[model samples]
Target chain A: MKVKKFLIGLADVFRFIKRFFKEVFYPPFEIKETLRQCFLLGNRSLFLILFTSFLAGIVFTKQSRPSLASFGAESWLPSLVSQAVVRSLGPLITGLICAGKLGSNIGAELASMQVSEQIDAMEVSGTRPYAYLVVSRVLATTLMLPLLVVFADIVALLGSYLMVNGINGTSFTLYFNEVSAVVTYLDIFSSLIKSAFFGFAIGIVGSYAGYHSEKGTTGVGKAANTAVVVSMIFIFVIDLASLQIINLFRVQ
Target chain B: MRTETDIIMPAPSQPRGNAVVEVRHVSKSFGDREVLVDFNLDLFERENLVILGKSGTGKSVAIKIMVGLLKPDSGTVNVLGYDVPTLSTKELNALRLQVGFSFQGSALYDSMTVRENLEFPLKRNLGIYNRSELDEKVMSALKDVGLESASNLSPAELSGGMKKRIGIARTLILNPKIMLYDEPTAGLDPVTSSEINELILSVRDKYNTSSIIITHDISCARETSDRIVGLFDGRNKVEGTFDELKKQNNEELKPFFNY
Candidate 1:
């Protein structure tokens, strides 16, 4: 019975995704609302992403310094830090942070609207709530997450540079030059692509949870919790899948 | 005692006109719970019809079905020449524009101010973008509801009565031909409830809207309804004016009128 319920839920989510794709391309597009959502999702999440990414960059570099110094290869610090920050840590941290922040936000907002009958009001008012609420929000998150990840990468690289310059007095130009030379176009492209998927996953998961939330206040709380948990799980799954696909291309 | 098969038709003495909305043999069930069985209704043009039933008696469900919000398991609902159940998305939306639903909770958008709430249906449904035109209609609707000064206030800032008024104002701004009020007086004190009853009457007089008010509030039904239909066990048990129903004193309806 539990398995049956799970399968039913999975099918419903697939249906929801299919509906989103269909409605998203329809005319009377909610361009204004979508842009507003993008601004809200990006602006609200910027501080948290920057703070955590900077700290991660510094901590990872600090931890790696001793091991590289023992090998008399501490000069390779900039290259190693840049590769790690750009190819993995930057996108991953941003994805997880947004999954927690934006995911819960979308879920709770829509769930509250659902419970309060605001969604119904929108419908009876001759407005398509799905197009206005779900599509716009999902589009905003999908479009903004990649941009946020790029900012995270830049800030993380800067944090790495600060740590390197404090210890070795390396010029800013030299450090950046070394970092750029070692980080390939493919690495940056793959990070961005991964972040985009992460964003799409977070947006869709959060929207589905909230749009189909059960009645009452408890439903709102449950929707928010489901969105965060499900989004985080999806992020890790997407990250793992992205790694395998990137590896396949490298091998080819 | 009224049996399940007992269906009371409207009195012949009461004049009836064209039914702008009609429901026939509508049966709806959620899982094992049967909410409506062979339910039938007719709402004439410009008539104030009240469907009076206690909580959980499918009063709201019947209206929802009429609006195409909830499709019944079986039956036909025709509102304004459109078959509600079979209408396409575009057609359903078109039909919805002519029908304004004021929810029991007032369902005002918390994120928007009262003016914005009123302006939403106009902007989205009617595509009215001209600034002066939007402002004129919004203020007019607010004036009708006697809340012209409260336009700048968010729903969270308003009292329960104020929120209900704003909800009605938002609906009225669209100039819907049919108004469906789901428990307009559900959670208000007696004074507020009576005020809402008066608003219903005034809205009808001014807008000439055909309304179906779903309420268990006896006073609300008495004050606003031109005709009252008693709903018991998901079917219409009695139909008449307030005084007629009180005079009939049908066993099933005695509890409703005794109060």
Candidate 2:
């Protein structure tokens, strides 16, 4: 039964993908409306992403200070911060940021639809509900998370850069050069790849939970909470697996 | 008691106009609880059939089954000649092209404006139309519901009655052959309820579309329904024209009549 249910879920994923392509590219692009959603999901999240990345960067720099000082390798701070910010922390942090915003929002929105029978209304209107709800969020997350992560990377690096400058004067040009030298295309690509998976997982899981919700108001709340928790856990798992794959190939 | 319209039998061999929906011996149960037991109904083209019953009597369940949102435990639901339970997803999509529904609470997308809500379906399903054509349809549907001025406003800004009207407008955008309404007049002021009833009747007349309405409002049911089917304990207890049901003062239907 468990295997059957798993296979059904896999099938549902493919079904959703098919609907997604149809709804997204078909002529009546809700481009203006979708852009509005993008702004809500991506642009509005900028400040929260910036604040969290700044604090995280500050803490990382402060903690790494004593360890690198012991080895007289404090100059490695720029490379270390840049690599961490760009590769792992940036995407993870940005995902978590969106998990709080987009995940919960999507859950609440869809849950309300389920609770109020709006989804059924869509189905009866000859409109595919999955195509409209799940696909829109998937596209939004796909486009938004990467953009948000880029913003986060810059904020985190700049935050860490400020911390390094406070401790010892390092020129921006020199610091950036060091960051570019240590971080390869592979590292950046791997991070981005993981973030996309994270985005997809977050959007789909959130939508699936909310769309299938049977409970009423309480159900909506529970769906929102569960979407974030489950997506966050999956994000970590995907992140680790991506890192492993990147490492495996790099070793060759 | 049933209405005069219910007494008029469906003409045999004659095309009942569009024959919008046909349900044959549909039975649905959730686990051991039989929500719908051997239910049968035929909705004619452009006819409004109100299903009246108390809560938990499977009125909503009946509509869900008809629309292919829920599969019947056994029996066939033939809408536009496509067997609902057996339809592939693509086929179901094609079948859905001819049906429309308005939920009890109007189920407007709260995040979107009335225009966006109306436009979402138009753009997705009828994507070939240019923006102007889409705009014309959206405006026309909103006008049909008397919500033309509220187009750009978000759903949150509309009154409950206006929301319901907007919901109807959204349903009309596709120009469906059949419309399913679940408690269209529930939870509204008496005046608003009457307005909705009038609007529903006017809509069917204008579009020549059949409707299956699940409702508890007796006045609304009597006013809007051509046929009234009474459901109790997942079974169709009594069905007749509104005048006929109203005339039968049987003990079994006494309580429903009092309301």
Candidate 3:
């Protein structure tokens, strides 16, 4: 019975995505609202992403230093950290953070609105709430998450450099030069591609849960929880799938 | 029994050309629980029809079905000459331009202020872009509701009565041809509830629009309705002028009228 319920939920999410695509290009583009969501999703989330990225890079580098030293490859620390952060960890951490922050926020906001009959009010007023509410937020997340990942990557590398300096006194310039050498365009592009999918997943799952929430106020809490859980899982799924695709491209 | 309209009730039901809203043998259900079974109503031009029913009697659901927000399992709901369930989303939205609904909770956009709340329907339904024009409409709506001082106040800041007024104002800004009120006075105090009832009456007289007001407040029904219908179980059990219904002893609607 639980498995049946899960499949039904999955099918509902697909239906939600289909409706999103159908309503996306209709008239009254809602340019202002979409931009407002971009500002909210991107600018508002910047500080948290930066702080997390910094911590991630510092911790990752500090832990890996001993392992590299045991292999007598301490000089290769910069390449390894940069490769790991740029290829996957940067986007993955950022995606998880967004899934927790933006995903939960969207879920709670829309769920409250739905329970209050605000969505129905909008629909009866001849304003397509689906287009104005869901599409704008979804589009913002899709377009902004990749940019946020790129920004997090730079900040994380800087944090990694500081850790390197603490232990071995490597200059910032040499550390960055090593990073640039190791992190290829493919490494950067593929993770960014993954971030976009992660953002898409978060937006859709959040909207679906909130929009269809039952059981009133308790349902709103459930919506927020489901949104974060589903989005976080999808981030890992996308990351794994992107790695395979990137490897195939490298082979080709 | 008084059969005439007065300061409290709206003017007597004026015989109109044709019905603007028509429902026939509508049946709806959620899971095993049936909400509306074989419910029917006809709303004529400029008539203020009040539907008096018990709680959990599917009053809101019937209203939602009329507007195409909820689909009935069986039966026809015709509004403004278009079959409601048959119309596409775009067409339904076009039809919605003429019909306004005031939610029980007001449902004012919590994110927007009073002025922006009124401006939303204008920007979406009519495509009004001129700053001064939008401002004029917004201000006029606020004035209509005697809330000009609250133009910048958010829905969160407003009192319950104020929110209900603003909700009605938001709908009024669109110049809707048909108005539906779902418990406009549900949570309000008697003083505020009567005030809202007067506003409903005044709106009908001012705009000459047909309306269906769903409420349990008998006094409110007395004030705003041109004709009152008693919805028992799932169908219209008794319907007449407020004065006429008051004179007769109705066993089924005894609780509603305090018989």
Candidate 4:
């Protein structure tokens, strides 16, 4: 069973790669349709990501202040907030948000299409259904996620800014300087890379489960649920592996 | 109803036809159970043949093998003269150019408009036609299936029959030389079934493309097929004009024809 599962995954990866290339050049580009999907899958979900980021930012800053103060490091508030937003929270929270929304939605949509025989129809029409359905959505997810992460990070910082000054008034310039001092290029790059992988994972897994879905309505729900859970697990696993690799380069 | 003689011997292969597709002693098994055992078929040019079988009789498997979607364990499938098992991905794709499939369910892309679905083949296979030409082709294909007014609609909005028609339209736009219909009207209402049957006949009459239809619906078989090939177990049970099968007073054949 394990061997069979592995082979299936390998075949699906190869199929998906082939599909992506085939679809990239299939004309009547459907730019308007793709943009509509981005709006539905990306933009519409921004409020949830933004709102969660804000609360997370506020909580992290407030919670860390007392601990830092214990070490006579209360002035590290801006630095701590900035590091949290850039290196960890931004991608993590945004990915979780997408895993819940877009992942489930994509899985359900594809599952229904499979159940309805739409995929087969495309195959018969001399169209590569994999290219038409999976590749476009995966590409959209890949391109839209980094931008969403950027938005989330910005909102998170804004929330942190409010929380930091709420308890003790601090000048905006001082806060800004302290935050910028701690946020290295590595922090930004690592988080961005992680989010892109997260996007890819979400799109591929969701489409796979949905595309191969059977058993009708129950199957649709199962695909959506599996996509969210599996992608979330992948996100955390990838994040941890990345952290260890990044740490390996420097002796802390 | 059309009698058995008219349905049994559909134009008898096709004038040497140069063997467009050949299923040579092909067999398939899933796990321990065998689905098809030593099945052989020859598909020639410009003929419409119907494969009839009960559910689970490997009708779909035969189509998959011919199309190179599934490889047979022990035989050769040659499509347009290219050896299927040995063909490169690019080569298989080239062969696919000559074949069109309408899956058991109408498989229109749920996310795309009917116009987009129809245009995809023209764009993919033909490449780079002007927008007006593409639009004209899409409209003509839709009109071929009596779905011209549904250009902007998505599959979700269309009924089961309409979706199937749109699917046929999409297949037509490709202008494939051979068409495969997998249970084309399995779940449709009776009225819709007749309409689809008419559509299938019209395709053969209008396009002159050789068609292989896999179906369990006897009505569809009786209506559109030039020759009905009965598939039982795995091998062909008996094949002749539909009228022959309908007239066979043999007790075994009686159950199949409900005599």
CA deviation > 4 Å runs, candidate 4: A1-40, A70-72, A124-132, A212-215, A249-252, B1-19
Q: lDDT winner among the candidates?
A: 1
TM-scores of the candidates are 0.96, 0.88, 0.97, 0.88
> Per-residue lDDT tens digits of candidate 3, residues B171-246?
9998999999999999898778888988998888888889999988888888888888888777788888888898
DockQ of 2: 0.68
User: What is the C-alpha RMSD, rounded to one decimal, of candidate 3?
Assistant: 2.3
Task: Tell me how far the alpha carbon of residue A1 in candidate 1 is from the true structure, in angstroms, after superposition.
Answer: 2.7
Best by DockQ: 3
- Give the CAPRI rating of model 2: medium
For all candidates, state DockQ relative to the true structure: 0.86, 0.68, 0.88, 0.52
- Candidate 2 per-residue lDDT, tens place, A1-252, comes to 999999997897677667666777774355655666677777768899999998888888888888998999999998888888888999999998788788888888899889987887777766767756777777778778878887788888888888888889888888889999999988887877788888888887788778877668999999899889988998889888988898897998
Q: For residues B1-259, what per-residue lDDT tens digits would candidate 2 score against the true structure?
A: 3444533332222245656677777788887888998888888776788898888889998988877889898888889888889988778878787888888888887767999899878777777358788789999999999978998999888888999999989888888888889899888987787788878888887887888889888877777788888887888878877778989985656776787
| lDDT (Cα atoms) of all candidates against the true structure | 0.92, 0.82, 0.90, 0.81
Q: List the residue pairs that clash in candidate 1.
A: none
1 against 4, candidate with superior TM-score: 1
- Over the stretch A117-186, how does candidate 1's per-residue lDDT look in tens digits? 9999998888999999999999999999999999999998888889999999999999999998999988
RMSD from true fold, candidate 4: 3.8
Q: Evaluate residue A173 in candidate 4 and report its C-alpha lDDT on the 0 to 100 scale.
A: 80
Q: Which 10-residue span in candidate 2 chain A carries the lowest summed lDDT?
A: A27-36
